[model samples]
Each structure stands twice: as structure tokens, then as C-alpha cells.
Target: MTINHRAEAERHLSKASFMTGDGPNATPVNPAAADHYLRMAQVHATLATGQALVADASAYRAALASWRDIVAHFVAWGLSFAENDDEHGTYLRLAQRLDEAGLNIDNDIDKITPEFGKDPRGMWKPPTVRRAEWAAECAATNPPF
Candidate 1:
């Protein structure tokens, strides 16, 4: 996984872990923890897939370092997110890291769909798979490592 993505996941996981522990209100907190674990798993899975697609060691290392920084921020925040809506914050931070690293997330439907123009509807099918495929395609082109 890219470092920034991992960091974001780690941050969420840490907060979730704390919510499962002594976090405020304690009930909804567990639900959030569940969400956190699921999201963490998703991030890890995406990273693994990206790693398999990339062959550049240096790029991979840099991505890993970025994720560590994100996780560190989360560790520093502890249970403070318990009262705030921080879900989108992680995505924003991750985007920032990718931007700083000159990495582009494959969310450009226009770019990805145009290539599939021959297909029915002239667009990619199933938004989730489309996103994943676009990301993998982008990774293949740039090779993050």
C-alpha cells in the first residue's frame, strides 16, 4: 500500500481501537470501530494490489513512508475524533500526500471510460469495479514501485 493510504487507514484504525476502548458514548463508538476495521482492510488490500502492479522499489518505499506519516498523525490524535466527523478528513489528507508525491488517484471516469467506448453504454460498468480497474490501469502506466 502507499504510505499515505496506509497512514490514513492506521489513523482511522487507531481511533477506532480507542473508540472500542474508553471512548465517549461507548455505544455508537463500537460501530465506528467496526467501520474503521473494514476501511483499514480495504486500504491494505488496495495497497497490496498496487504493489503487485508496481515494480519500482524507490517509489514503493516512498509510498510506504507516506503511509507511516498518516498513521503517525492518527496515533497522535487518539480518541479525539470521537466527537468529530473525520471520515472525509482522511481522504483529504491522503489526497494531499498523493499530490505532494506527484501521484494521481485514478478517479477520472472520463479518462477511464473513454477507453471502454466500444462497450455498451459507452462507459465503464459497475462503479466500484470501474474505479478499481482505472486505478490498476493507472498504476500499470506509472509504476509506483
Candidate 2:
């Protein structure tokens, strides 16, 4: 008549794991206890991935222009105030993101301040402009025939 505490603990641990749906495709051993935080992680994993990247790569990146516009609108439209030294780093990072996204800023001095500058060059353009530019380039090149 021997008692095994470790075996009993292991059994309980396994039962808890299954009840909480702890692993991928794990069938709930105790369906009554299926509601747990572990499922939140699985649901977020499906939802939080970058779904905005489904289109053509250029268009996907170009679509970031709308985000840039929103930033600019806030920077210009917000309440008037000067910048603080401590918050300069955040503005610097924001400025760098605009530059990294192929947008050139005017009023370069304001970039270091909280306003993130006043002007943005090379902003969004319509697809028709791209088509016309492509047509011009194609005409400039000699025909293969």
C-alpha cells in the first residue's frame, strides 16, 4: 500500500492543462472549464498579425502615406505650444519614420520639436500619375520590334 504524491500531482497538472486549452489543437478534456486566459493568446495571435500587407508590396507601402497624412494633420491642427527637451526624442523618432517612408519634411527645424515639422514633401499621388510616368518611360525606350 504505497502512496505516490508526484504521480498524483502530474495527473492533476495534465488535467488542468487540458481544461485551459493550453496547447495548439488541444481537445478540451474538461469542456466545462474551457474558458481561460490561454484562449485569449490564441485569439490575439490570429487577429494581430499585419493584415494590411495583402496587396502589392509597393501599394502596401504607399498606403502608409495615409498614416503619414494623419500624423501631419495632428501636428498642424493641435493646440499651439513649444517643445520640451525631454520629449524631443519622441519627435525625432517620428521625424525619422517620415523620412524612412520616403517623405521629405519642410521647416526642418521643427522636426526636433514636438510638432514633428510643418511640411511633408513627396506625399501620396494618384495611380494615374504613376501610369502616365510609366507610359512616358516606355515611349522613351526604343521598341524591341
Candidate 3:
């Protein structure tokens, strides 16, 4: 969760706790108001969770782009990575996870290849798993041909 959102959630939760006289030093509030505060706290907590998800998604996108660029740079520099190498394995695993998560849409080579000042280039992962996942999803959704 982002700090502000988390703080907001905690603050609302604390207010609800105080209203309910959960703290020994706290005075009690009307039961209905306490319920309202509790609900508000839940809302804030949900917002915090949502913020965390958004942050994670943003980080993933940036990381994906960065990793793509790194791989491209290494290949251009003539850095040969065997299939059993850790670097290659890490990227392959990430590609597989992205495929499973339905985020394998950026597998197109031309779309990802860097143009100097452009975006990243695709890694050398075999897109078979990603392709199969996409195919299964498309079939499951029953999209019009």
C-alpha cells in the first residue's frame, strides 16, 4: 500500500476503535456512529489495498520494460547466455508468469525492439506457453472469429 493510503486506513481504523471504546483510555460513542466509523475504516482499508495493487502493476510494467531493455543490450553486446544460465532462467520464469497472468500481449518483436530513443526489445523466451495461454483464454471467452 502507498504510505498515504495506508495511513488513511489506519487512521480510520483507529477512529472506529475509539468510537467503539476498544481502547481503555477512549470514551464510547453512539453505537450507530461507531458502526459508521467501522464501515469507513473498511472503505479506507480497501482503498489502501487497491492502491497497493495499482502500485504493483505499475512496478511490473516498468520492470518488464527494463528487463527487456537489459536483455536486448546484453545480446547486442554479444553476451551469450546458455539455457541453463541463471539470468536466462530468471527471465524465462518471469515470462512464464506474465503469460499465466494474461499479460503476454507485448510479445511482438517489432513492437518491443528498441529504436535507440524508443522502447525495449523482446527477450529470447519461446512464446509457446504464452501463446497457448492466450489461445486457451480466447477460446474460453468464445470471442467471435
Candidate 4:
């Protein structure tokens, strides 16, 4: 039997509620963790669709950027889950495919660093906190989609 990796990733992502709570009790889940899983689902879905469609270089590059963003989020949180998780093999496979396609994934990592800002204590704030602040700021300035 073949596994539908994209579907599996999406299932994992759905386990997190993001803005809303999950399950009967509606317990709030960690938004950062939710975002991490969502991004993981995105990475898998993008690769699945891109490969099926025979996507161009730009699409592959965008996927690489998204993957880098996930890594950056983990870095900001001071966590090594991205490097040590069970799905690490899947992540590396996708990365290798992009590399083989001539997409420089390292370039995306350089761009992701500036999005994280330092906290009052002079340490880099967690990605969850930064993402919430950014979302609030954007909502205040721009209309919701």
C-alpha cells in the first residue's frame, strides 16, 4: 500500500486549531506549534502538487522558501525539532529535490533571518510571539482577506 504523504501532513495540521480551539472541550493549542504543523503540511502539499504538475523553477523555489521559513521558525524558538523530528527524512527529500532542480535553498534561509526581532531582554523572541505581533499589526493596517 502506498502512503499519501500530503494527506498525512494535512491530517497532522488539522490536529492543531490555530485561532480556535480543538476537540469537545475546545482546549486551546499552542499557536506556534499549530503554525509549525501547518507549514509542514504546506511543504508536503506543495511538493506533491508541484511534482505532479511538473512545476517550473519558480514554484520549486517558492516551496524551498516555505521550507526555509519553517526552519527559521524553529530556530527562533530555539528548538531543534526540525532537525530531529521523525519527518526529517521527508523534509530532506523535498530539499534534495529542490536542490537537484537548481533551486538554492540556502538563499531563502538568509532572507528568513531578518523577520525575527529581539526581545526586551536582548534575546530573539519566539516565532509564535513575533507572528502574533505581525498579524495584529497587519490586521490594524489592512483589511482582512
How accurate locally, in lDDT, is each candidate? 0.52, 0.46, 0.59, 0.57
Any idea how many clashes model 2 has?
Answer: 0
TM-score of each prediction: 0.25, 0.25, 0.46, 0.28
For each candidate in turn, give its C-alpha RMSD to the true structure in angstroms: 26.9, 20.0, 15.8, 27.6
CA deviation > 4 Å runs, candidate 1? 1-3, 20-29, 48-145
Candidate 3 lDDT by residue in tens digits, 47-116: 8888889989999999997876665454422212323446555655655565697755344433444533
Clashes of each: 8, 0, 0, 0
Model 1: how far residue 33 lies from native, Å: 4.8
What pairs collide in candidate 2? none
Question: How far is 98's C-alpha from truth in model 2 (Å)?
Answer: 3.3
lDDT of 4 by residue, 1-145 (tens): 8556678677867865544556566567667778877887887787677655755777888987787677655443332123333344444455456679775454443444445543422223334545677799999999887
Candidate 3 differs from the real structure by a C-alpha RMSD in angstroms, to one decimal, of 15.8
lDDT of 2 by residue, 16-71 (tens): 56674446676545554543323543444444333224335668677776666666
- Candidate rank order under TM-score: 3, 4, 1, 2
Model 4 residue pairs with clashes: none
lDDT: worst 10-residue window of model 4: 118-127
- What's the true lDDT of residue 7 in model 2? 48
Task: Evaluate residue 80 in candidate 4 and report its C-alpha lDDT on the 0 to 100 scale.
Answer: 19
